[model samples]
Target: MTIEVRVPTLGESVTEATVATWFKKPGDTVAVDEMLCELETDKVTVEVPAPAAGTLSDIVAAEGETVGVDALLANIAEGEGAAPAPKAEAPKQEAPAASGGGAGKSIDVMVPTLGESVTEATVATWFKSVGDSVEQDEMLCELETDKVSVEVPAPAAGVLAEIVAAEGATVDASAKLAVITSGGAAPKAAPEANAQAADGKAYTATTPGKDVEDAPSAKKAMAEAGISRDQVTGTGRDGRVMKEDVAKAVSSASAAPKASAPAAAPRAPSPAEDAAREERVKMTRLRQTIARRLKDAQNTAAILTTYNEVDMTEVMALRNTYKDQFEKKHGVRMGFMSFFTKACCHALKEVPEVNAEIDGTDIVYKNFVHMGVAAGTPQGLVVPVIRDADQMSFAEIEKAIAEKGRRARDGKLSMAEMQGGTFTISNGGVYGSLMSSPILNPPQSGILGMHKIQDRPMVINGEIKIRPMMYLALSYDHRIVDGKGAVTFLVRVKEALEDPRRLLMDL
Candidate 1:
């Protein structure tokens, strides 16, 4: 009756997750859709549910364990015609065992590197303290990176035994931040102690003013304890010390009564009670991810954006005339994205290089267009791809786009739905932006940015008059795609968008 559970796939590039919690314990009965445990991936937290009604028999994994996708998680005694359990690789308990962690044993937990190029983060604040009950997916602390404040969650539910890193400390990616145990020890004011050094310096092995003997070990211990030598109390002989001393110093300091977060900086936003009021809003998951990816993509890619303005006279007239009928027939309003998406698809089909990805040694050209439309939600920008845009009916495209967009705003889009796009289109014009030169999403050679429609003076039959003009920008990887290819691809998109009939006729 033992039904084995496994880690569901998280995202396209995600290979593993740190256990955040075991919501149900042994002998607990669970419903078919019940959340059995929580998982913290690099990007977000996800709940792993019980596939069927069952009695939880055992947790094959513990909190804080990093498990690969499809790894066995727990075993439940299925009720009534228990479906056959799916096969999984042997549980990764062996790896943790091999790495040397014993039951009830405590280990150092550190801040992980979020990306390849990111080096470190500043500890903005700690949410839990020593002896505090911690839960999986519960925010443990916040880290201020170069741009945003990121909420870091506890890998598993346990007693927070220590907070090694305090607010405002800039620590390396691998720096230790806190310690957890099955039950945290009560807060105790650490008594100062000194290690009699060979050089006769009384180095107090406690937080602040610690001496060191080996620089590497000191750095490593400091990295592991989330403390700098400047803040640790050294009591070694002649101010010379070791790693154990540093760890001891960190633990003692953490055991003390902690201070409350100081009132927000004078300049920090405060709530107002007047009309035209504003509220300080937290950056959402989508927004943070977007900001990180856009910045990272910019840093990694040699990007260049080409600009061109398109006359929307024909498309505008077509939409205005058929708008009511099209809505009545298709059950969706005619928006500018379909024309743009179709135009991008046409351009990509012609210049397959624009649809290609850069491998280390080769370029991968996609045969179909998985057009990514960046939907701007209250949470932020999320690009959900329209699978095989070339094959879908206009109504189908509208429905898919509508559904995906709704799900994105609702934070319901799965990791799979957000992935696998050959190219991206981010329309700044939706926010009524006059113009924008967007960046290329990594791996994709090109991205098309759309802007607002505005009336401007133009020449027509040797006379100046008002006309609706739209600015378009195409950002491309200059390394893989040449200037000519970029311009040609953009020109193709422009031509299709200008003459809406071309998109319908497959031109």
Candidate 2:
């Protein structure tokens, strides 16, 4: 009998992947669920595993070649002789059973399927150590991907015999992470003591003892922030300090007044000290993708920026008047984003070219608006799309923005939440940017950039008056959007924002 190995689903919006590595070659004897090859996609790396115990008969997808979902990767020829290979090594496995107090089968703990568009992850933390007993379906470790943190659970109740992938290791889907010896006896000491021993650290009489070990990522974050362990509180299992706790501590410390003198200013490094001072760190996958896409947009589009300023006096007053009542009724705070999103949706209807995209030689016009809101996180910049924004009410728009923004910051957004955007809006005002020409998020014709509102004197009705004003920048692709259309879109947005009633009336 012959078994075919095919690529699994690559998640939402992911259609293809490039073969990265092949662990087994043709004619190699393989066990069921053994990893055979790896595929690298734009968002993640996927590992293809053997479906049955057999001899790998053929390789269909070679390394560096791109293959689509459900594409043929390889084939296996099942033979009777293949099933007896493990039985022949029975004596080698008996030695462990004699010392460990039980004769049991060893099971491989493989990486689970990461949610939408994610293919690979970094081993963030291990909750269990080698020789520690684990319960079925109990969380053993956490994997950190570009989009979210995934908790990996144990496959079955057993003793963790070996840790194949350690902390900070990048692993693909279905790759072996650890080994569990089923029905093995628990060690003499507690799991905590075993963990400490494995890490080469011990509690002493002279030193202060801690309940749980600090997470590896948390320690790195504290070092980078110049913070001490005693300053930040732990929130993880058994009072272990996590990376997020250190970040919170750093943020709180920045807002407080310093009681001590400031440190000396950095001076120019001497030739001898240059090498020691400079550090080189590899770019993360998210950062690398951001760089590539931004450059690609610049190269492909005939980008042009049109600037217009809007009077924020009306919008600010309207928000302040109804904010309390609005929040009480809708359970969401009234923010400037909802106003901008609503105004943009109104403006997009007036100038459809700004909302359209170029598909090859043809221009594709979308009647509905999928608004992309650009958000910056610790990893990099990401744009989460709000579907059918044009049809949503103010309260719904506010709720969606709040939810997606929170998820984006926490790196919990899925790929589907980031795809299918017809237009994008980026508010650099939150970071105090006065004005910036935002780049186009490819395929989309335009992006609206919002800047910080400043109280400036304006001549209105031939009289000089102080008004809260903001500069709006519309960057559009000249190929699809004419200068007139781009200018019209910006003007409409400015008018709608200056008079909030215009958005209500759909003017």
Candidate 3:
């Protein structure tokens, strides 16, 4: 019987993938659930497994060919066609004493599936070293992708035999990371360690016969501190050097200089001296992705910014009155974010174009508001989405914002939580940014920038008075959102915030 192989469903927003590699060729005997091919999409790598024990009969999609969901990839012929290959190898397996005596089965430790749009990852740390015994499902290493950190667990209980991809190396999804000999005992001492000890030389635990590379961040830190790698004892997996190690080394080095050397006379350094002191560090994967996407938005969109000011007297007064009660009731503090979120939702209803996106040759209007709240983390800036914000109450909005913000800072957000935003709100106010134009988050037509609120003199009712004022900037894609729509959106937000009663009345 012949069975057809088809592409599985890719994740949300992914439509197609390219055949990256074929593990099996035509007429190759394959077991059920054996990996037959790998597909690479813009976001993640997917492996296609064989449906049954069979012979691969044909390849309909060759490597490097693009295929959509449910497209034919190959075919399998079950039954007699796959029988002969195993019988031919029977003689070699018959010698059980030679093959099984104190030897265990070797299993490959592969990189786990990364989250959406993540193709590669850096080996962040290894929790186990070569010859270390581990249990099945024990975490062996952690891989840092552009989005999140993924922990790779052992596939079977074993002693790790080799490290194929060491710390500081970049590896693609499903690539071999290490080898584990299932059921194998850990050695008392490695042969190389004994030999090096006898020769009066120190040995570092790493892959045999290969030099372990130091992390790029560590290298840059070392250069700036004027310390060599030999001075720091690495605490990372397999004795890999890390940035934290360099920091400790620098701390120790600083104390020595203070104790042993006399204070130097102050003088301006020469250009040559300045040049020698500079250190270069490579950009991280998250930073690179942010740079690429920001540049792409600039290159593709007709971006423009509109500005307006808001009187915070009403919103601030309203919040101060009910904050204690609201926090007690909802178990979340009432903050400016909920007010801004509600204001934006109210504004989006009036200026729908600001909440819409441009597809190929068409404009897609979203009736529901999925607000993206831009947050800054130590790694980089990220936008986590709150679905259907138009229907959420002030308390709900505050709780959602607080939860997502906490997760974003800790790098625990999932891909689904970060996608599907209809409009964005970036609050530079927390960082004391007075007034700055914000950039539009791509696909979403508009982004609202909220700046710091300060007391300003304003003429209200023909009298000069001090009032809390904030500058609001609305950045939009001119291709889909007209200038008038952008201006109207900002005005609506200003009105809602200035008179909090307007929001409650749905005005």
Tens-digit lDDT string for candidate 3 (1-507): 998999988878889999999998998887555678989888777888776666899999999999999999999988775445633223323222222435665566777767555778987666776667889999888777876667889988877666677666788765767766765455445323321222244434655223455665677778877877679878755567777888988888777845467879999999999877676666767778788888989988899999999999999999999999998999999999998999999989988989899899999999999999999875679999999999999999999999999998766787778888999999999999999988888988899999999999999999999999999999899998888888989999999999999999999
Ranking by TM-score: 3, 2, 1
Compose the digit string of candidate 1's lDDT tens values, residues 4-52: 8899877668899999988888877665445688788877666786765
| Backbone clashes, each candidate | 23, 2, 1
- 463-497, model 2: which lDDT tens digit per residue? 99999999999999999999999999999889998
Instruction: Give candidate 2's error at residue 412 in angstroms.
Output: 1.9
TM-score of each: 0.51, 0.72, 0.74
Evaluate all candidate structures by whole-model CA lDDT and list the values in order: 0.69, 0.81, 0.80
Off by over 4 Å in 2: 1-82, 85-99, 103-105, 114-127, 133-139, 142-151, 187-269
Decreasing lDDT order of the candidates: 2, 3, 1
